[model samples]
Each structure stands twice: as C-alpha cells, then as structure tokens.
Target chain A: MTETILKVDNVSKAFGALRACDRVSLDLRLGEIHALIGPNGAGKSTLIKQIAGNLRPDSGRIEFLGRDVAALDTVERARMGLGRSFQISAVIAEFTVLQNVVLAVQGARGTSFHFLRGALSDRAVTEAARLQIERAHLGGREAVRASDLAHGERRRLELAMALALRPKAFLLDEPMAGMGADGVAEMTGLLDGLRHEAPILLVEHDMDAVFALADRISVLDYGQIIASGTVDEIRAHPEVRRAYLGEEDAA
Target chain B: MGRETLLNAAIALGLVAVPVWAHLAGEPFIITLTTKAVILALAGVGLNIALGHGGLISFGHAAYFGLGGYAAGILAHHAQTFTPLMSAPFIIEGTKFMPVIWLVAVIVAGLAALVIGALSLRTSGVYFIMITLAFGQMLFFFAISWPAYGGEDGLVIYVRNEFPGLNTLDPIQFFALCYVILGLALWFSHRFGRSPFGLALNAARQNAERVQTVGIRPFRLRLTAFVISGMITGLAGALFADLNRFVSPSMLSWQTSGEIMIFIILGGVGRLYGPVAGAALFIALEHFLGGVSDYWLVFVGALLLLVVLFARGGIIGTLAGREVAHD
Candidate 1:
C-alpha cells in the first residue's frame, strides 16, 4: 500500500448535545481521491474543519505527513502543505484574479515581509500564479476583480489558490457546491487530472461527480462512517444503502 | 501617467508655490497655515496605512502623536535648562537638534504603538475602535496629571528646535522643511501600499479568514501596519510641536484623533494623496469659516456628512473615479 500522506485516527467532536463527528477514522495515501460523502447534517463539514485545524476534535488525533499536528493553527497547517477550499467560494473580493493567486503563492513560498518591491512585479511569484490560473482555466480573466467574476469562475479561482499552495494533500470541501451542470462536468475533468498532482480528500454533495471521481468512497451517516470501500463495494454495502443512498440510487 | 498622479503633482506644486508666493508677498501667516496642514496630512497618511490598507480602525493614534510631541517638548525643555534627562540608570542629556528629536520621537511613538497595537489588535471593529479610544484617553489623562512637564498648562520651547544649516525660525524655511518631510511620507505610503506586505495586508482586510486559509496570519500584518502608522504619526507630532514651539495634552485628546480620521475621510480613505487633500480642505474651511462664525466646525461637520453620504470615496475618489485610487 502507498504510504499514508494524511491520517485521521478516531476523531470525534460534539456541539453541546450534538455529536458532529463520532470516532471518525480515515486516511489518504500517496495518490488517490478520497471522497467523503454524506447527507447535509452527517458531519462532513465538521470533519473537514477538524482536519483543516479550524476546529478541535473532542477526542482523537490527526496526523499529517507522519507528524502529529494537534496543536497547530489553521495558518501553520496550511504552511505544512494541507491546502483547502471553502464550501462557499471565499476569494478576496476586491483583488483581481492574478492578485489573489499571487497572494497564495507568496504565502506558500514563506515570508510575505518583502515591503518595498511591488507584488505584481515580482517575476517569480507572478509567473507561478499565472501557471496555476491557467491550469484552473481562468487564463483570460487575470485582471478581473474576484467580485466581478462569474460564480463558476470564482470557484476556479479558489481552486487556483489551493493549487498555488503546492500542497502535499488537499482538503477540498464541496468543490462543486454551486456550479452548474456544465461547470460540474468541466470541474470533474479538471479534478480528474488533479489526482496526479496531490492526493485529495474531497467532501462533496454532487453524487454523480462523487461516484465518477472517487477512487475510494466513504459513506458517512449521522456523524459516523457507515461504510468505506472502493466504488463497487460502497455501492454494494447494505447499510450504506439504507442510511445514505436509497435502494434505487444504490442500484 | 494616471490622472491621480497628475492631480497629486498639481497639489504638491500648488502647496509649494502658494507658500513661496506668500513669502514674496510678505504674508508669513499663510506659510504657517500651510505648514500646519502639511503636518496634519502626514498624520493622516500614517493612519491610512492602518485604516485603509490593513482595515484596522485605530481610534487612539493621538496617543502616539502626543507621545511624539512630548518627546520633542521634554527634550527641548531639558536642553534649554541645561539639565540631565536622567541620572540614576544612565546619564542622558537632552538635545535640541532636529534630527535627534525626530529620532527619539519616532522611537518613542513606535514603541507605544507596538504595545497598543499588540493589545488592541486582539479585537476588531467597534471593540477595536473602543479599545484604541480608551488607550488614547489613558494617555491624555496621564499627560494631564504629570506636573513635572507643566501638567495641563503644557510645555513650551523657548526657541524652535534647530535643523542643520537652516534658520528654522524663518516661516518659509520651516514650511519648506515640513513640505519636504510630507513629500517623503507620501512617497513611503505609496510604496508601502503596493509592496508585497501591503498586498497581504489589503487581502487580510477584505477577508481575514481567507488570508489565514492561505497560511498568512492577519494579526501580524495588522500589528506591523499599526506600529508603522503610529511611528509616522509620532514624527508628525514632533514636527507639529516644533512648528508652534509648544506641546500640550490636547495633542493626545480624542478630538485630535477624530480630526486625523476626518482628514483621511475628506480626501479619500485609501487613496494615496487622500490625507493631503483632506488637510488642505480642512485648513481652508477652518480659515475661511472661522471668520464667518464662531461655530465653524458645524459647517465642517456638514461637509463631512455630505462626503460620507454621497461621495463614497471622498474628494479624490469623486474626481478621479473609483476604479483606481489605492492601487
């Protein structure tokens, strides 16, 4: 088996009386898209938040790149190469597409303390940002303000920033949340190619995209992983059918 | 070149030319008035770094400004009296040299800013504003109770502090000195706003959480901007004291902080030359309206209301269009 790049060991969290995540254990290896799918309240977002260091689990451990990261903050975790995208697109609204990506490049490469030189004129950072922007298929809209971009383009811009992190693992939270059918198809193709760059832990609601793109699917229901397996096995799991996918959808 | 750049050049030239014309026409008071505007504009520039770019609204900047003025006042007072500033820890004598006073003022103000920013940056929005205002008030009262420096009566320099190779006592010369310093400050603010750090600071302002997700801490950026802002305002405060040959607790008051904020708002909050325009308009309003009525500030308040409601981006923003101000 490929060496595990990210490991979540029995992580559980609760909000007052509600258990958002209950002893959830999962792993992402060297090169694979691990999709975490569930109904709206099944605690997928809560799990993603814990792994991204935005929330602390009530009980359990998260290990990234064979190192314990229990005490690190969101910024530190991102620096350590765990890139993430928000469920709702969260690009800097006033910044141009190029500027937003340039900031991400600057963040990942280390210190942003260079105070005299113009950020856009820095050839190295700007070039890297351009590459990512092109890869995300937002080539011609470099100077367009993020607020002015179309809904799908903003999602692409978010992905561009995540790619600029040059991360070891990606913790993507619903990459296709508000995208249209065409946008989904294009994103699915884009994500299909992204697995070669880094292992992705995708939390998505689009079942067709999930089924098509997931190398391994984990069925989450009521804050617990009901089943985990390859697409065929997950499709065959009886309990997963009852708890998450109905009989018609599972078939 | 951009229209804003042209406008900035015209404003700069006009500032220098008016003072020169007044000197030739024997109106020394005009030069003094222009000097005051320039110094106040420099303070506004400092606050802009925090409020405009970093999205930090610091309501206590007068603390640094007053501290800077006191640094100059206290130093000049001791120097004129031929007394040692301290004797126990180390023998430190005061100096009247402009460069030395400026250095002390910058360092003192920068240090205070560091402390205030470190604490105040912990909260944001109204709480941030309130915390900063509280700190400023603390300094104001501290200055009032410190009788060694004349307490509420304030301290006065017997002579204007000396600058190298120039008679600073001359109104035109002093105005020129202030103009040059203001020019340097505007240049620095311009460069600082476009730098890589500035980009991150701007991004942090727009969305701090997004900045964090990209592995950048917004607090550090904001605190740095605040300290730098405080340092510049402190420098301006020192110069302001030198201009009047006096330093008072009123320099540390909440009213001073509000005036500084008004300067930024009047010009265009984030625009590079916003402070310069704001200060010019303010001084002009005060000079013209004060003659008409004792309640001149009410008119200024009305103008501010109009700008906030209709102008959105302030004077420059209204003239140059909104697409390209800070950038």
Candidate 2:
C-alpha cells in the first residue's frame, strides 16, 4: 500500500468551554484534493491552524511524509515541506510582488544567513520565483506592491508564495473566499493543476469548486467530521444531507 | 548619481569639512564640537540597524553606549595604574591601545544586547519598548552605585588611548581616526542593507507570521540586528569617552537614549546617512543655541515637533524627495 503523504491522527483542541476540534482524523494521499467543507463555526480554520503549527492541539499528532511534527514551529514545519496559505490575505504589502515571492524562494532553501550578497542579484532564486509568479498568472505585475494588488491578485500572490515553497502538502484555508466569479473560475483551474504536483487539504466554502475539484469530500460539523467519502457517496450520506447540505444538492 | 548617493557623498564631505575648515580658521573649538557630533552620529547609525531597518523601537540603546564608554574607562584606568584586571590563575593586565579598547567595548556591548534582546524580543509594542528602557535604567543605576570606578562622579582617563602611528593628543588626528571608522561603518551599513538577511529582517518587521511561513525565524533576525546595533554603538561610546577623557553613568541614562533616537528621527529613520545629518544638526543647534540661553531644549522641542508633524521622513528624505524601492 502507498503511504499517505500527510496524516492527522485524532487531533483534539478545546477552548475553555467550546471544543474547536474533537478527535478529528484525516489523511491526504499523493496527487489528490481532499476537500473539507462545513458551515460557519464548523472548526475548519481551527483544524487548518493545527496542521499549520499555528496552534497546538490538546492531544494529536501531525505527520508530514511520515515524520512527527509536534515539536516543529510553523517555520520549521514549512521548511519540512508543509506549506500554508492564511484565511486572510497575508503578503508583505510593502514589498513588490517579485520581492515577496523572492523572499519565499530564498526561504525555500536552507537558512538565509548570507549577509554580504544582495538578494535581487541572486539570479537563480529570483528566476525560480519569477516562474512561480508566472505560474500564478502574475507575470506583468512583478513590480506592483502587494498592498496595491486587487483582492483576487493577492490570493494569486499567496499561491505564488506557497507554490514557491515546493511543499509536499498544502494546507490552504478558504483559498477561494474573497474571489469574484472570474477569479474563482481562474483559481479553480489553477488548484486543479496544482493537485498533480502535491496533495492538497483544501478547506473552502465554495461548494461548486468542491464538487468540481474534490476527490473526496469530508463534511465537518460542530468540531466533528460528520461524514467522509467520495463526492457521490457524500451527497447520498444521510447525516451529511441532514446536518450540512439540507436541500442544496452537492451534485 | 542617484539622490541617495549624492546626499550620502554630501553628508560625508560636509561632516569632514566642518572640522578641517574649523581647524584652518583657528577656531579649534569647532573641531572638538564636530568630533562630538560625528561620534554621536556613529551611535545613531548603530541604532538605525535595529530601530530603522529591523523596526525594533529599542528605547534603551544608551545601555550599550554607556557600557562601551565604561569598557574604555575601566581598561585605561587599569593600564595607567599598571594593575592586573584579574588575579586568579592568570594575570590579565589592561592596555591603553585604542584597537584593544574598541574590541572590548564592542564585545561587551554585543553581549549585553544579546541578553537584553533575548528577553525583550519576546514582547512587542509598548511592552518591548519598556523592557529595553528598564534594562537601560538598571545599568544606569548600577553604574551610579558602583563606587569602585567612581560611582556618581564617573571615571576619567588622564591621557587618550594610543592609536599606533597617530598622535592621540592632537584633536584633528583623533578626529581623523574617528572619521575613517565612520566611513567604514557607513559602507558596511550600505552593504548590509542590501543583503538577503536584511530583506528578511525588514519583512519580519512588517509581518513576523508571514516571515515564519517563509521558513525564516523573525526572532533570530531581530536578535542579530540588535546585537550588531549594540556592537556599533559600543564602539562609538569608546570613541566618545576618549574624546572627553570621561566615562560617566549619564551615558547610560534614558535621556541619552532619547537623544540617540532624536538623531535618527531628525535625519531619516532608515536612510543610512540620516543619523549623521541628524547628529550634525543637533550639535550645531547645541553649540549655537547654548550661547544664547540654557533653555535650548525648548527650541529643540519645537523643531522636533515640527519635523514629526510636517516631515515624516526627516532631513535626508526631504532633500532626496522620494523613497527607494526596497527601503
């Protein structure tokens, strides 16, 4: 049997009175989009945070490529091939798009302790970053500041940065949240091709995209995964239909 | 030439010209005054690394400055008396060599920054500012209470430390020594500002979480910046002590920190030559205004208020007209 690329084991996180994630278990296989969809306050963001190392789970283990990552911080986890995109658009707003992606490229390598040489002059890293930027369809906007970018463009820039990391697994939180109709279609096509490079654990509210891209759909509700199966199987699942979809068909 | 480069060249020339012109005109007082300004300018350069580039508003930099002064004063004092610094298994005698004094001052201050930065970097905003200030106050009060050196009175070196072939007693020669160091530091700062590490640091200042996701630890970058800041400021402190032949606890005071901050704010926060212009302007204001009335601070306050309200980037920014892409 082929080992899963990412494994999240019985992760549980509780706020004083509210349980954010309760014994949630999932696995991501290579070249597959495992879409996790839930209503508001279903703990999607909290679960993503745990995997990204932004928050510590009360009792659970996250393994990337078969290595336990409980001790690693977000940076260390990222260095170990766990790429993440924030729910909110997060980019170095003061930096140009090229500069922002170049920083990600520089970090993709080992420690960036080189103090004497200029970063812009490092052609290899800058060239690689340029490729990712182009891949994200941001070719002509290289010199534009991140702050000045449109909402959809910032999302693309975030993808450019995450893709630059060359991660084995992607934990993207609400990647399609703020996108407009055209932006959504464009990003949907991008994420479709992206899964061929590495497995993705997508947490999005876009059901159309979920139906289009997901190899498997997991319905989350009130800190628990109510159901998990292929899109066809999940649509027919009574608990998922009753608890989450109501009458809006997933098909 | 670019605006920044032209401004930098002008600053370097102007700082050097003031003392040389003053010496030839037989107004020796101006040379001494300029020397003070240059040394303080170097200290401001040091702070700019952490404050401007790193964006760590370290309000307690005077701790490193005063520590550097004490390093020189303590070593020179021991050397003059021909006493060993310690007498356990080995006898370590102090030397009146300027280079040795500088090395000691830089190391001592760097270590102090490491300790303080390690603890203070964990807290940010007003908490970080206060922590650094508290550390500075601790050192200031400690220096005042320690009677072995001179306590409140401060320690004095009878003669300035030797600088190999140069005449240390001659004001112009000493100024020349300090001027060369300032030049080297400015070059280093320019190189460092362009480095990849510097970029990551600037990024960290803007967003630490994003920096972390990029696989760079913002804490380490900030800590290194703080240490480098301390080392450079410490060297300036040693030079300043040599100029006055005095090492006082006042060097570590928060007032000294405020004055250092004023230099950066008045010049341009992140601009490399910002501190130099600021220090020169501050010294000029002091020398010219001190003769009029002792209430020079009130006017200084007014000018500072004007700069803060009208000029966001300081003198260099005003002269240069625009900001560079990366800075």
Candidate 3:
C-alpha cells in the first residue's frame, strides 16, 4: 500500500443548528485519486475547506505528512505543498496568462520581495512558468489576458496555476463543475496524467467523470459518508443505488 | 521602448523647464506655485500605492503627511534652541538637513502605517474607509490640542531650512529641490507597480480568493503596500513643510485626505502619471478660479461630481481609453 499523505480523523463541522459536516474521516495516499461525491449541501465543500485550512473543523484532527496541520493557515498549508483549486474559476482577470502563472511560480520560489528587477524578465522564473503552462496545455495562450480566455480555458488555467506549485497533494473542488463535454474530457485527461505526480482529493458531482477518474469513491449523504469502496463496490451498494445512481439513471 | 515612456519623459521635461523659465523671467510666484504643485503630486503618488494598485481606500493618509510636516517643524524648533530630544542617557539633538528630516519622516510615517493598516485592514469596503477617516481625525485632534510647536496656529521656521551646497532661500532653487524629489518619488511608484510584490498586490485587488488559494495572504500584502505608501507620502509632507516654511494641523485634516484622493481620481486611477496630472490640474484650477472669485471651491466640487458621473475614469483615463496595464 502507498504511504498515506493526508489523514483526516473524525472531523465534523456545524453552522448554528445545522450540521454541515458530520464525523467525516478519510485518508489519501500517494499515487491514488480519491473522489468525494455527494448531493448539493452534502457538506463536501465544508469538508474540503477544513482540509484546505480555510475552515477549522469543530472536532477532529487533520495530519499532513505526519505533521498536525489543524492550526496552520491557508497560506502556510499551501507553502507546505498542499495545492487547491477552487470550485469556481479564480484566475486574476486583469493579469496576462503568463503573469498569472509566474505569480504561482514566484510563490514557490520564495522571491516575492525582489523589487528591482522586472518579474517577467527573469529568465529562471519565466522558464519554470513556461514549463507548467505547457504541461497544462496553455502553451499558446501565454500572452492572453485571463479575462479573455474562454470558460473552459479559464478552468484549465486554474489547473495550470495549481500545478505550478509542484505540490505533494492536490485538493481539487469541482474541477469540471461548469465545463462542457470537451472541457470534461480535457480535465479528465489532465487528472489521469496527474495521478502519478501527486495524490488528488477530488470533490465532484459528475458520476461518470468520478467513476472514470477516481481510484476509490466515497459517497457522502447529509454530510456523513454512506459508503466507501471501489467503483464496482459503490455501484453495487444498495443505498448508493437508491439515493444517487437511481436519480442519474432516471435523468 | 514604449510610447508611454516617451510621453512620460516629455511631460517630465516640460515640468523641469517651467521653473527655468520662471527663474529667467523673474517670476518668483510662479516658481512657488510650481513647487506647491510638485509637492502635492508627490504626496498623491504615495496615496496611489494603496488607492490605485492595492485597492485599499485609506482616508487617513493625511495623518502621515502631517506627521512628516511635524517632524520637520519639531526638529527645526528644537535645533534653534540646541535642545536635546531626550536630555538623558542618550542625547539625540535635532538637525535641519533635508536628508535627516526625510529619513525621520519616512520612518515615523511607515510605523504609523503599520499601526493604522493593522487596525484598518480588519474591515473591508465602506467600513475600511470609515476606520481610516476616524484615525485621521484622531491625529488631527491630537495635533490641534497638543500645545507643542504652536498648536492650532502652526509652527513657522524663521528661514527655509538649509541643505548642503544649495541656497535654500532662493525660490527657483527650492522649486528645483521639490521637482527633483517629486521625480524620484514618481520613478519609485512606477518601479513598485511592476515588481513581484506589486503584481501580487494587484492580484489581491482583482480576486482576493484566488490570491489566497495561490498561498499569498491578502492582509499582509495590503499592509505592506500601505506602509510603503505612508512612507512616500510622509517624505512629501516634509518637502511641503519646507516649501511653506510652516507646519500646521491642517495637514492632518480630512479635507487634505479628500484632496489627495481627488488628485488620483481626477487624473486617472492606477496610471503612473495620473497623480502628477491631477495635481497640476487641481492647482491650476484653484489658482485661476480663486483669482476670478472667492467661492471657487463650489465650482471645483461641481466639476469633481461631473467627472465622477460622466468621465468615470478621470481625465487621463478618458484620453487613454484603456486601463493601465499593470503587471
């Protein structure tokens, strides 16, 4: 078995009287793609937020690479090689594609205070950003403003930015949420290629994409995990069949 | 390398030539007016860091400006009596050199910014504006009631403070000093706008969530920019004190804060030369309109409202037809 890179031990979160995440626990290992799937308001986003250090869990422990990361802030977690992509595309609109990616590289390189020299003109920085852009299939769109990119292209740019950090683990929230057929395919292919590079915690609703890309699927209902298994095991589970898959087949 | 650079250089050269002509034509008042314009523009450039690029509307910048002026005023006052600042274990006496005054102004204002930013950044949107305004008022009241250095009436230097190898009393020479400092501050603002930190600051303004997800803390970035902004404005305040040979609590007033913001908006927000253009236009309008009538501020207010409603992008922004390309 691959070594576990992330461990979430019985984490729970609540909003006033409403339980957003209830006793959720999951482990992610190297070289495996873990998918967390649920209906709307299933507390998937809340759970992911806890892991990304944007929200603190009400009760539970989160350990990353054997360190207790429950108290670290978002930027601190990111600096420790935990990369996240938002559910909504969050690219800087006014900045050019190259500048956006270069910022990501700058974050990783620890040279944000270099004021005298132009950031774009730095050979090493540009080379690194160029490689990441090419990896995300944004090689031809380097000079284009992020605002000018198509919807699908913006999604890809988000992925490109996350990858630029060279993270040890990736927490991707709905990488294909608003994407069309072609966009989904491109994203799936990108995810397929990324499985060998780092562990991925994917929270998505597209059953077909999840089953195709996820090595292990976890079904979340009402903020609690109803079942967790391989794709065949999840497909055979009676509760999952009645609650989630049945609605999909009916549609 | 770009048309923007050429235009900037031309404008700078034109400004430098103005005082030279004034010197030759024996118009000392013109030199004084130009000096005032340059000093105000320099201060505007400082505010532009937070206002234009960082998207932080700081209404308390006048506090730093006043602090700088007070630094100059207090130093010159003490220097005349040869009094020690502490008179204890460490004897720190005052000096009248521009460099010493500028250094003190920058340091004090930068520290003030750190405190103000740490507190003001806790709120966003309209709340941020109000908090900054409240801080500015606090400083203004302190200066007015303190009883030190002439209090509400203001402190005046008997002579313009001297600089090494320069006649500080000459109108044209003093104007040249103000012009050169303004030029340096403008260059600094331009360079800061293109740096990595500046890019991140702009990113934070555009999409703060995105900037955070990429591992940059928005609050820290904004605070840093705010401090730098205060330091630059504080330097300008020192220059202004020298220009008028006085320091007053009026430098800390909310009206001064509003005027600084107006300069940026009237020229074009976020443009490198916007503050310069805005300052020049504002001073020119004040001069011409004040000469024509005593109630010139009413016209100025009307014009500002019109610009805000119809122009949207200020004078240079209207002419340029595009946003300044940052990062």
How far off is each candidate at the interface, as Cα RMSD in Å? 2.2, 2.1, 2.2
B118-204: candidate 3 lDDT, tens digit per residue: 999989999999999999999999999999678899988767788888998999888888888898888788778888888889899
CAPRI-style grade of the A/B interface in model 3: medium
lDDT of 1 by residue, A1-251 (tens): 78899999999999999989999999998889999998889999999999999899989999999998999999999999998999999999989999999999999987588878888888999899999999999998898999999999999999999999999999899999988999999899999999989999999988899899999999888899989999899988889888778845747
lDDT of 2 by residue, A1-251 (tens): 75599998999999998999999999999989999999899999999988888899999888889999899889899999888898999999888898899889999985367777988888898899999999999998988899989999999999999999999998888889978889989999999999989899999988889989999988889999989999999888999888888758644
Question: What are the chain B TM-scores of all models?
Answer: 0.98, 0.98, 0.96
Pairs in steric clash, model 2: none
Candidate 1 docking class: medium
Encode model 1's per-residue lDDT on B206-301: one tens digit a residue: 999899988999999999999999999999999999999999999999999999999999999889999999999999999999999999999999
Candidate 1 stretches with Cα past 4 Å from truth are A247-251, B325-327
TM-score of each: 0.98, 0.96, 0.97
Please list the C-alpha lDDT of all candidates, in the order they appear: 0.93, 0.92, 0.88
**Which segments of candidate 2 are over 4 A away from where they belong?**
A247-251
What 10-residue stretch in candidate 3 chain B is worst by lDDT? Answer: B318-327
Ranking by TM-score: 1, 3, 2
Q: How would you order the candidates by lDDT, starting with the best?
A: 1, 2, 3
